[model samples]
Target: MAFDSLSAFLAMGGHGVYVWAAWGVTGLLLVGVVIHARAERRALLRDLRRRARRAQYHGASGAAAPPISHQEGRARES
Candidate 1:
């Protein structure tokens, strides 16, 4: 082993603090990214499901839902 002991390996020749801090920050950021991505995916799926239900309801009534682009344009104008 390059390090004589476990303590020495962890200490990293007096640079342990900086090295460990960097590793901790990297781990935290990776976890945050995964969590954010999952939340975004869930939100997108929920929005899609809601839109499908709305379309089905409108179709059953023989009324067509407005095109997404037109709705978006009207919303923007408002």
Candidate 2:
């Protein structure tokens, strides 16, 4: 199929509104997915870094201690 002109093709036989709306939704969804993936990756890396630091500290001290948990702190208070 050939359009009479670029503008005519964009009009898409009077269905351009639906076509553009669908494209807009798809673009926004893709952007949201990319943002979420990046955020999750950053959080995972941060957690790994924290664990590595804790392990290194224990190794240097030559003492193996259980990980300190927030619950443990609260239990100590009680």
Candidate 3:
């Protein structure tokens, strides 16, 4: 409504370049954040799965050592 026509709206009284550039940069950054988050999530899940498999393999073979509690560790250190 404020703009008379499509071309005039796009021109934005000669300030369109700056306004559109800002919008483009903001959009790109938002997209990059989304992509990075997804990649991190996938890597975390893959690492967890790998750890689980390793634990399972060790446990099945009776080679996995039992986890020590903090108290036990301190006693051993002393």
List all candidate RMSDs to the true structure: 5.2, 6.6, 8.6
lDDT tens per residue, model 2, 1-78: 688988988998999999989998999999999999999789668755776787787676424534445563455323
Backbone clash total, candidate 3: 0
Number of clashing residue pairs in every model? Answer: 0, 0, 0
Question: Where is model 1 poorest over a 10-residue stretch in terms of lDDT?
Answer: 61-70
TM-scores for every candidate against the unseen true structure: 0.59, 0.53, 0.61
**Between candidates 1 and 2, which one is better according to lDDT?**
1
Taking the tens digit of each residue's C-alpha lDDT, what string does model 1 give over 1-78? 889999998999999999999999999999999999999789668756776797787676424543335443356322
For candidate 2, the TM-score is 0.53
Ordered list by TM-score, greatest first: 3, 1, 2
User: How much lDDT does each candidate structure score?
Assistant: 0.76, 0.75, 0.75
Cα RMSD for predicted model 2: 6.6
Candidate 3: give the clashing pairs. Answer: none
Please give the lDDT score for candidate 2.
0.75
User: In angstroms, how far off is 16's CA in candidate 3?
Assistant: 1.6
Residue 24 lDDT (model 1): 90
Error of 3 at 31 (Å): 2.1
